[model samples]
Target: MSWADKPNGNDMARRAGASRSDFDGDFAALRQRGRHLIAEIVRLSRQLTDLQQAIGSRRGAPGRGSVSGGEPR
Candidate 1:
């Protein structure tokens, strides 16, 4: 290889810096996505709890389409 083709200290440092910047950006994006997913999971959990309570209340009511075993056939 030519002497000019050899990567010097400054060139290597710049490449390392660019790679670190890219990694940091990717990590931040992943963390943000994870937080959003966790929030969605919490919201869904609350909705499920509410639906279960509604079903439980309906089970004791008369002629409201509530089945016997609480399971669909």
Candidate 2:
């Protein structure tokens, strides 16, 4: 019930630092996960661009495949 029963400053700081280290490690892991997600986003964007380009390259003339045989109605 006296001052001796209460933890000292050094003990409190050490405990705080121990918990702080766990938080720091968690932050580091989250940061790495964010980096991986960003990289995946960039890769997906590149894939989308490539798909758009491929589609554009494969398109035929406007009236080529029409059922009307490209003739005027």
Cα RMSD, each candidate: 12.3, 15.2
Q: Write the per-residue lDDT of candidate 1 for residues 4-69, one digit (tens) a residue.
A: 464563666666667667658756866887899899999998887676667757665433333344
Candidate with top lDDT is 1
Off by over 4 Å in 2: 1-18, 60-73
Over 1-73, each residue of candidate 2 has an lDDT whose tens digit, in order, gives: 5334645546766666677676587568668878998999999988876765555444642422433233353
Candidate 2 structure, TM-score to reference = 0.57
Badly placed stretches (over 4 Å) of model 1 are 1-18, 61-73
Q: Look at candidate 2 and tell me the lDDT of residue 53.
A: 56
Model 2 weakest 10-residue run by lDDT: 61-70
